[model samples]
Target chain A: MIPNLTLAVVAGVLFATGVYLLLARSITRALLGIVLLSNGANVLLLVAAGPAGEAAFYGRTPESDMSDPLPQAMVLTAIVITLGMTAFILAMAHRSWQLSQTDIVADDVEDLRLVELAVRDVAPHDEERPDVDDDAAGDDRPPGPGTDAVVEP
Target chain B: MTGIDWDILVPLPVVLALAGAGVAVVVTGRIRLQRAVSVVTLSLVLVVALALLVGADREGPLSVTVGGWPARMGVVLIVDRLAALMLVVSATVTLGVLLYSIGQGAASTDEERADEQAPLPIFHPTMLVLSAGVSNTFITGDLFNLYVGFEILLASSFVLLTLGGSAPRIRAGISYVVVSLLASVILLSAIAMLYAATGTVNMAQMAERLDALPEGTRLVLQLMLLVAFAVKAAVFPMFGWLPDSYPTAPAPVTAVFAGLLTKVGVYSIMRTQTLLFPGDQLTELLMWAALATMLVGILGAVAQDDIKRMLSFTLVSHIGFMLFGVAVGTAAGISAAIFYVAHHITVQTTLFLVIGLIERYGGTTSLTRLGGLAKLAPVLAVLFFLPAMNLAGIPPFSGFLGKAGLLQAGAEQATWLAYLLIAGSVLTSLLTLYAIARVWSRAFWQPPIEPATEGLERVPRGMTLPAAALVAVGLAITVVAGPLFAVTDRAAADMLERAPYIDAVFPGGVP
Candidate 1:
């Protein structure tokens, strides 16, 4: 039987990679990060159930020697949930491509501006943009929505 | 040993919401019919919740063990004072938000073209599903069932958040979904660990088994559970997604999200801390988080010039107040936290709905563009004013009462951290007051910076009525704070002592 150590180590590797990628600037990499992270969590869930013993089906093995079925069931449910989430996120990433040119998760304009201010140690700048002011009671810079300075091609 | 009477009530709220969702989906083409179904389902849920509250209060905790499986093998639904009280409050808030959404939806359908209102048909069904998820989270006795409830809510919210199909909504939805999915994965893994550490997932059974575990192991499990929940609750250091995500959703979606979702996380923390890992082993950590969340959240609020972002930060800040009470580990503190959650849900949702009105009337939520609103829409001004002050913990409001009770509890403990939290709580409240005042002065008091290019539309009666109703309900909580606190105190007492809950489930001695 595979020991908990191997499982845990693999899980750790997956998690480390996932987190590293998650911190990446690209949305696709972040999506990949989510996939790896969820899979790692699933593996950990299995490890949490202890070393495998016997088949889950009744009469195939004595009940005492049977592997815990709850975690398996939980893992199944988690996998399904992760599937749905991944698909949804993929759609969002696709939409980002359609609407804008890039697949990077841009920070909202306010977030980007704050980062800009910190880096340059300069005062804020207000710039005009498309989209925010639609009607008559417009003209205020409603933060020009989200974009990252570093994310530009 | 299971009584069939309360057994039926345990699943009723969730069942009604889901069944209603099913019917609403079938009637989705007709927005009017869908609205009718949504209202009826939530209203029925509210009525059932009130009955559950009365039953639980009068008859101690009632439980239903699913499928008659032996003790640790099956799911259990518990209706205790704490669960019942949360059920009632959550149902009330969801129902109020549903009505408000209908109003907003109807208003938009009347004015906007096809593309804008395209998603309105599905909104009612999804809203029902969200309500079911919330109800399930509150009532379920087992941990995995609660996780299922969270998933239900998360899926529905993922849809609701991106309803408008606008760029910002999708961007914000991506953040929301990613954060929530991460939290769900962590929560599932933690449950697996908890089940492995103990031999069961039935909470009562696990509590008994976990008592025998090594101290270090118990602490590990406790921390895992806490971290998982902290992410959901938007506690400090884990709340990065909230302000970014919530402010971009449609108003009703944001209102409901602001009102209930994070509170469900807080509710779970309360439950687990009291049941499986009782006492103050994690109190020090929770206390620091409490202080940090309050201070950081309020400071975020102060820095925002947009109404939605400002309100979102205030929401984060106020969660700190509830966590503070939980950290205190005293009956008064826990009760006060519960009371504060109730007050915050109503006031937060009301403020968001009011902001929706302001956005509509002024054509923007940016404080820089908004002003002379008090002169234009006095009804809207009053609606915004009452809840804004209430949220800031103004006197004679439930917010003030809840904070006062929490501060009194912390002071009684007399710990240095508790004292620091006390000071933090007061400072946070004042800062919140200042933040709202910034909005008031810039948006309502000052004359409009520019002449109106178009006349402001009178807010639809439907919209104002629901917002006003919630504000009045908040006022009712203040006016009747005495009885409410008494109920809260009793609920808190029942929650802190695990014996009654366990005994009710197992009949005789705990398993």
Candidate 2:
């Protein structure tokens, strides 16, 4: 039989810890949390497959009594994918750190601010604006939306 | 799951071979050698892809298992008309981009000098890895394998998207990374839940089992999977990350991504919704999402001066057209969506490549910084006009044909959703026309200004030729619409009727 309350509690604790770290600002912590969460999910999947009384190593035959191996194989694949992604994320974090001198999102407000500036800079009306000649051609749609006005700051 | 034979899975090895070559090129690190290797590897993959397509076209659907394991036991790769067609399209676009990138040579950005020590020849390897991942995704028969394929592509794409290492690229790359990782997490969780519920990862088998599950549980699980794919496909609200981040990448990188990557997401959604859960309820949700995606994408497109950014938004918008077809839950609708996807893949890539050419020749991609390109480069003008107009769904073009097919299918569905699709499509087309017209008026038709001419430079033969070649292909598709439509129609038919696929995998029955 499965380890009942102990295994459930451990899986729950792992999931909670993972969720906490994943929400953190630090990329490294987030990566670590993904790993933990995946492991937790693996355990949960195993428990869902029914009782896990004994290790597969103890039982030579899977037909008689053994924890399912499919979930284990899936977990193995998940771990490999996680490792590859973690490496890529670390590289990205390093690059972000080098470029902006900070890995935190708040420090990279320049680009976000640029888009706002661009939106505001577009003049409300131009000769190309459809409303210039559409007084008699009153439309239900928003006025400027139809105009092929220039959109550069 | 029984009619499919177990012998048609040779494309996997071919895909891995190219991936291995890319790894070798990166490890070797000699720039000249890497370039040569990339060209050879890409061309080889293209040839193999073509062969696979032709072979499958003649012999029908095929499947092969890892080692000797059964479909439920080990990884399975299946090839049918749809998969073969996607492989060929992906390889062709990749081949073109590989040629263009190799000819363009080393990038000339200040960031390259600053970060020269970390990695060398970043683009070539990443592109190869991405190709392998795309190929794997298209061919794989299991859900978890598809997840792995997505991770492979996403991780490599993060590298390619930020290849230049500029401030904007890095910033955009960060958002792209976070959003993509979140999607992956959601997808993985869905896989976990599905596995827990069914104990199998094979898609065909799961399709059979999914019907037996309680409707509530299945609906929740399917919704999770749909949300994840939607994020990857950049549909409507999930699309915020696309236009900003896609425009930050180098042109060749962006072009290949536009051609293949998001379509893979669309492809997966199509597969799952059409084959596994053919219900009427999700179609309504998809219809609303399609309407929003079309309108929002075009609206964003209208508000952009940057050609790349505008095109990126339009990319988001056009996804709605495809989803509209798939959302109808009719044979006609799925067929049209398939046709639309194939057409959009080639047409969009050609447009992006042309835009890159425009940026190179005209000095900037922004309308404010560009003017009088037609006077200086008439050939480039023709190149840009064809795909741009086609993308806007002008008549006598493949884009128009595909859009008409989708519209026809939408009408045939004859529901409130159908009317919504029809209206949304017309609006999206008009906005698309306006966006392309804006680019044309500013970048091509307008008279030259003094400062702009001073910055204007001759387009390099390296860049111009690829753009020219792509324009030719785009035009050929338009001119030969009848034949192309037949191919797309057949591919669509094969996809909608999943028996060929299920049969190829099972060979007897799925029992």
Candidate 3:
């Protein structure tokens, strides 16, 4: 059985490595850091429980019995969840890269300015306005009438 | 023998699984079929949930031993009134959101096929999975099961968060994923420590064992658990990821996520504080955290010009009110928290749906770009009014009633801590009103810009119906405040009196 202190030490090393990866600039590396941190935490959980025999993914043996099952179950759930999240984050990175040809976050100011410029630069309906004017002229109102009312005139 | 047996809870998970299967079929490539199935399944789930609540309301703690194993050895699904009532509320809001989503699609004629790389194909199934996970979290009698449930919902949320793969969304998703992962690890480690010390993972069993552990060990376990759940709940300092991530999701997704997800975290916190470590020490830490979260959330809301982002910040801020109830560690406070959570979910989701409607009509969510919507869509204006007031906790609304209950409880204790909570609630309410007024003045009251009007006035029928329906729901709750508060009061009582829960799981009592 490993000493509790030694197990904790190993877990601490894992956590340090995980934290370093988490602080990296790359999104992918950061995700890896999350994975490592979770595993480290899992190890810490095991250490907290005390010495346990090695347990295979599917086995009924002394090795499995020696380890705490609850943390193991939690670890399994965390692993599955991490897998889904990592995949989603990678997909996002790919999309962001596609949109801007860069993986780093882009500023929205340029996009906003472009939209403003487009609104200001173009007249959307010049031809249509003259058509509306010609149509209005064919209506039944008397042209250049000076009277306030027809009866008064 | 003549009464309802309190030993039957596992079947609720089965019903949820069935609902998920129905949703899976709908989302697997059939758009029309998906809408039908989603609505029908949601309605059925809601009905069953209500039945569970009423049946379990007066009954003692209801537990179902899974796979015929004893409670100590096997997984147990317990349905106390609190769990059952939360299930019903979750189902109700999910139904409302689903209807709104379908209505929006129909209005836009986008019902046939979503835009290129549009994410509805995957969204519906994941939402069902998310619902199932939530139900499991409430029902399970064990801590490990709760951890597993959190993972299930969190995984689904990753897809839901970045559904469209927009640039901002991607950036937001990265932070959200990392933070949630860290919390999960911390939670797992805590679970490990508990099992090691107690040789059991069942929450009921752990509560019994926890009392016997050394004070230092117990405090460490408690702190670790609180930190983990707090991160999930988006409590004050740990809430950085929520505002950025939530605003980037599609409107319906945002509404549902806003309504239920963090509340689950708060629910867990309530359970942990009450069950595992029932004392004053943790409440002090929680009380301060609640005040900070309340203050920080509203202040952030006031600063945002984007409608969705502002709502997300408020979502974080209001969590403090619920936490305040739990921090008081009294029956009245917990009950108030229950009531507050129920009301907040409806009000928050409705407000988000209204924002979606504004975007549909005004062509942008930016306050600077939006104006004079009331003249164009009076219905939309009316819809926005109810939830906005409700969120600000104005009189005659569920929000006010819930806040009043929380305040009353705080006053009963009347400590400096309670005073801080009261002051924070009042301040948060005022700031919330200010935020809502900003939205109103910018989006509804001012004259419309000619530039903003071209190609922007067209609101699809699909979208309008959902927005209108959500508004109606907000008003309905306001009208029916009496029944809702009664339900909340009952739920709060059930949670505080722990005997029903403990007795249900271990009929033969603890060893």
Candidate 4:
């Protein structure tokens, strides 16, 4: 069976742009990337159905002339699954915005801490040293007498 | 063979869990009812899985075409020895984790509940759905069905991972979700290409047709499938999201994910490699990947101070051992890999659950802050100690047996790469021991930095019981190792021969 070059090219472009958007720091863009990527995959599935023919129906089309029904079934299943996931991710993005007022993905805190320790050239074993002047440690400390005294009580 | 109809049972595990999930959701906010539904559903699945295991071992592979469609035209669910064994082990662990989570929910104080989003009522349903997804992946005979199974599990896992919608979890969830989506897209595209080439999505049909394709096309398809599965399996370079995302979730959530999700990926890799692309075409590449996964994962584990992160790293490392067995591409190798998957699932989940207990008892997972835990909770110490040693490949344990099997398989292959992997496996084992030893010495042996905080409750029995049961189950695997090995050996032979699976799907031969 001959393949459809035009549809294949469209799928490739979709994948390329989807991956580019996926690399962004913003969660909303990442969600859009997933949408595009799944759409690209769906298009590829349609292309995999091969050259178009009459709609697959029991009595309407001869066996040899009917288009493949399997790929269309698979593409529909994929689309539904993607729709569900898109809704879930959208909910998560809203929740993230509510929590932090921004949906930009943040670096892992533990990973960042490890990076900071490496930058300071201090062994992880010595991380507990009181005199090390750790910024994270300072942040965890309760506010001093001059600031937030009423909030503490 | 027996009077019971085994073919009908192939889909029961998936069906039961999914139906139970629906019931669980309907009973939401009624915690006790929801819990009952989950427990009963999983327990039924376990029984069904056990029956399938026995029947498959005794009779042969059992399959049922969905909606009464012919094998070539419609979806099929088949349960051979490998799939049945996976179903049994997964059901067992899901039940164990479910009980532990229920215990944890009961024991948590109201203030603790308010702090972390109250262990949302949605947990039970999602967990059940995850189990269904895992079972579906194991039993599916259609490649596209396998993809659907993956999405089922992944969607549920996304919910489980970020149950509370807290800042840290959302942060972790975003990365986890996007990476998983990317993997899914890649897998879908690969399926499309395979369909375009082979004209069928049924795995048995594909297995037959793939051999007639051009060598380059076959190789490209194989590599694409491998890349997608490798990400899910957490092999070397693709594993960055795992250690970062897994530790932030609540304990039981992390435990189930650690136990089953990655193993699903490994299972798919084993299936596709042996069935559809049966040759030594990519064995060397797999060996190199296994070696890198082992060494890098263990080295990361050694550097971690948090027990959760350390165990997560170790989880990634042990996946290498399974991959090593797969790379060997011999009967002995695949058998050992299967055994290792079962052993690792139990030990890893037990370790995580015990760590949860530790966090509750000691008030922190940080080694620097935790001290004198042996004196405070000797039972918890024992629970933790046994699994840690097992994970580190202590003798007379299932872990040791599984590792020894892989080592022996590597020795039989005796390629230079196999030797390199054997050496890597031993070193990784030793480093694993060192990592566990460090945790023991620092957390239990050292004196308390300060007196235990007042009102710190004793580690609740409800939580401890399930963990101890899992530890016992791990030990039980060692007790039954001989028979288990025999079954896995037969399973491997069947997988490699390819006749049993293909003939089961198309008993009359391909049309």
Candidate 5:
């Protein structure tokens, strides 16, 4: 069986750790979690191709013992996809840091406003006068609590 | 067997799109050239897709095996009535959005074209790539290729979603990327399991093998695939990322995203259910999920202040209508769902494009800030009103007909869950009308409290004409509904009788 259990155990631990980090507030931690998850997924794919076989090539082995090359090819493509995804996330994280000096995804003000409206039971039709005054220029600030100021002072 | 009939059309759309992307890339800085290349490419795609649709309609299902690799091995491009109709709808919607973006001067203007990604502007190339990926997703017959098609579109979308790298867009992009990756991971895992158990990923082959698996194993694989597709479809519980993600995008990007992306997932669910797993084991579960998606999505819409967020929520909700039909597991129900999917794609994109114009004409989309648009821009009022009513399933419109079909089919089933969906569908339709009417009264009918600074933006013909054109597409669906419904009827018939599809793709048969 070529230690199928060992790879399965490793995948489980990776998923557990990955899920833990994915929930963290920090963007970098989330990025790390995505990486771990991708790796675990790749391993799981390999495991799915059967536990033992020789390399899949023309002269490597009999057809029965030949490792299925399709899973390996699929995993390679997946690795490439994860690489591209990682790059995009890194760019987003960099941009986040550039704008806000932090990599955490801050709460969206509009979502917060909607939530607050629900909490306060303010009808959307009657939300104009006082609501705008309170949030848009509450004591004359650039943004309300939920909104973040990009570009550090 | 069919004398090389559909094979030629099979690769042309994706090939043309990829080539267009290449040209757009080389001439990145020349906005004028980019516009010409983009429009010509998509228009060509639209024409070909329509021909394919008509040909498939006349000829029944059409399929071609790639690289001559034989059945169950080659990547097949199938043009069944279902896939062909979806192709035509997606092509029309994409072409409409492409023109809208160009006419909106979204890509042409130097100011808007400000590159945050690289030295050269990427919007044109990325959009071309995105359209190609969408076409590929619709055509691909095998399981793994479908995943590849999704990856192509998702990669393109990441660049599009965070176009400006502005704070809100980047934040939205993060969630979109994460949720999309999560879906991909789950789909990949399920595919691996499917391959392991059945030893094949060609869907027609799997159909033969799947029924033989132990019930537990079969259910697990089916749920894994459903969950993955549901996440893509933005079904209720998994739809958390949609509202947050879509609203922050630019007008045209958001329009295409809202219109096309979730529907692809819905189509996948329908295809898989009818083809591979032809039973009603999960019918109740899907019906309940469908009901929740409708009520919760519309409720979320009503609660929103902004037009885009509200539209996004409704997008999620109407997906429920499609699922309701599919879950009924009958020919009428399936046809109704197919018709609704086609109708929703056009109407949703048109509404989003109209909102873009509303934002242009009125200076803001927030109902609070916008008012008196009925007088200010009557054409804009007409543009918004028609689709809004159509989307609400008002009489004589395609949306109404589609919903009526679903309701009639649900009534025939006589299950309590079916009745629940019927009530939920009607209630949701009325609520959609209310939600949209609220937008109309607030944004167009009533006098503005401060009179939104409209004259500042100088609403151009470029943007308005495209919105008008898309509205016309929505209307065309109504006029052609008799024939269109017949087509979907045939598609439903084809799907339920899987022999033609499996035989067409696999020649002799899967066995």
Candidate 6:
């Protein structure tokens, strides 16, 4: 069966652009990237169906004239999955924005701490390990008397 | 012989879990009822899965076409030895983890506040959906259906990972979601290409058709599938997302994800390799990948200060052992890999659950803050110690048996690369021991850094009981090692032969 060159090219473009956007630091851009990549995949599925012919309804079209119905069915499933995932990611992005007031994805705190230790050439398990515990505990600790004294002054 | 229709039960694990999820969602406000629904559902799944395992082993394989559709035209759910084994192991762990989480939920919040508090009402339904996804992947005979199964689990995992919309979890979830999505896209593209080449996505039919393709085209298709599965499996160079994301989730979430998710990827790799590819073309490449995954993952583990993250790294490392077995490309090797997968799933989940107890008892997971736990909580120490030793491949534990099997398989292969992998496996085992020993000394044996904090409530028995039960299950594996090995041996032989699976799916031969 002859393949669809135009659709293949479009899928290629979509993949390239999608990957480019996917590498961005912003969550919104990454979500768009996922959307584009899934669409690209969907298009590739379409291209896999070969040259278009009569719609695949049996009895309505002769068997030989019908386009491959399987890939079309697959493409539909991919579209629905992509739509669901897109909605989920959008909700996550919105939640991230609500919590951080920034759309940029944050670095993992533990990973960042490891990096900081590496930059300082200190072993992570060493007793001299940086007191980064402050970051984790800062949110939960009650206010100290020193802070209250300064405020009273 | 008993007149039981075992064929009808092949799809029950997935169907039951999914239907249970719907019922669970309906009973959202009634926490006890929701929990009962999930437990009952998974218990039923365990029963069905056990029956399938026995039937598949005794009968070769059992298959059912969904909705009575023709095998060539519709989805198939086939339970051969390999799939049945996976179903049984996964069902056990999901049930175990669910009970542990229920216990944890009770301990962390009083019943009056449970309806409005954490462990949110969404957990039970999502957990059931996740189980259904995992079971679906294990049993699916259609490639596209396998993709759907993956999406089902992944979507649920995303929700579980970021449950409660906490800031740290959301940060981790973003990376996890993106990486998993990318893998899904690649897997989809590969399936499309395979369908284009073979004209069908039914694995049995594709197995027949793939052989007739030109070598280059077949190789390309194989590589595409490998890349997708490798990322999901968290193999070397693609595993960055795992260590960063897994440790931030709630303990039970982390446990279940660590236990089952990567193994699902490994399971798919094994299926595609044995059934579809069935050659030594990529075995060398996989062997090298296995070596790297083992060494790098353990080294990362050795450097971690947090117990959860350290275990997460070790989890990645053990995936390499399974990969090594698969790479050996022999019946013995594949059997060892299957056993390793089952052993790892139980031990890893148990360890994580124990760590959850550790976190609660010590008021932290950081090694620096934890001390004198052996004296303070002897039961918790034993709970941690048994699995820790098992994970470190101590003799008489399933971990040691699994590793010894892989090492012996590698030796039997006797290729230079296989020898190298054997050495790598041994070294990784040593490092795992070292990592566990360090945690033991620092967290349990060391003197308290600050005297144990006062008013710390005793660990609820509800939580400890399930964790203890899982530990006992880990030991039980060792006790039954011989029989388990025989089962895995039969399963491996069948997988390598490939006929049992194909014949089950298409008894009349590929149309």
Give the true-contact fraction for every prediction, in order. Answer: 0.56, 0.40, 0.71, 0.80, 0.62, 0.89
- Which candidate comes out best when scored by DockQ? 6
Query: Once model 6 is optimally superposed onto the true structure by TM-score, how far is the C-alpha of residue B396 displaced, in angstroms?
Result: 1.1
lDDT of 3 by residue, B331-387 (tens): 888888987887888889888988888877777899888888898888889888888
Task: Give the per-residue lDDT digits (tens) of candidate 1, residues B1-511.
Answer: 3346755788898889999999999997887888898999999999999998888887888887777776577788888888888888888888888887777667775446354444447888888899999888888889988998999999998888887577888778777887888788788778877876876778888889898999999999999889989999999999989999999887878899999999999999999998889878889999999999999999999998799999999999999999999999899999999999989988998899889888878888999988888888888899999999999888988899999999999999999999999999999999999999999998889998989837677678788888899989989999989988998899899888888888877886766
Residue B70's lDDT within candidate 2 is 80
Per-residue lDDT of B363 in model 4: 79
Candidate 2 colliding pairs = B2-B507, B3-B503, B4-B503, B4-B504, B4-B505
Across residues B1-511, which tens digit of lDDT does each residue of candidate 4 receive?
Answer: 3324988899999999999999998888888999999999999999999999999999889989999999989899899999999999999999999999999888888876665443558889999999999999999999999999999999999999998788889888988999999999999999999999999999999999999999999999999999999999999889999999999999999999999999999999999999999999999999999999999999999999899999999999999999999999899999999999999999999999999999988878988788888887889889999999999999999999999999999999988889999999999999999999999988988877778557356878889999999999999999999999999999999999999999888988987
- The collision pairs in model 4 are none
- Predictions' DockQ, in order: 0.48, 0.28, 0.31, 0.61, 0.52, 0.64
lDDT of 5 by residue, B150-218 (tens): 999999988989998888898888888988988988898888788888878888888889989999999
Q: TM-score, each model? A: 0.93, 0.88, 0.87, 0.94, 0.93, 0.94
Which candidate gets the maximum TM-score versus the true structure?
4
DockQ of model 2, rounded to 2 decimals: 0.28
Every candidate's lDDT: 0.85, 0.77, 0.78, 0.91, 0.86, 0.90
Compose the digit string of candidate 5's lDDT tens values, residues A1-153: 343788778878887898888888788999999899888888887877776678877776788888878788889988998999899899899998998887777766455665554534433423565645444333223343334432221
Docking class of 1: acceptable
**What class would a CAPRI assessor give candidate 6's docking?**
medium
Cα displacement (angstroms), candidate 2, residue B216, comes to 1.6
Q: C-alpha displacement of B393 in model 4, angstroms?
A: 0.5
iRMSD per prediction, in order: 1.5, 2.9, 3.7, 1.0, 1.3, 0.9
Residue-level lDDT for B342 in candidate 1:
88
Candidate 6: global Cα-lDDT? 0.90
Estimate the lDDT of model 4. Answer: 0.91
Alpha-carbon runs more than 4 Å astray in model 6: A118-153, B1-4, B110-120
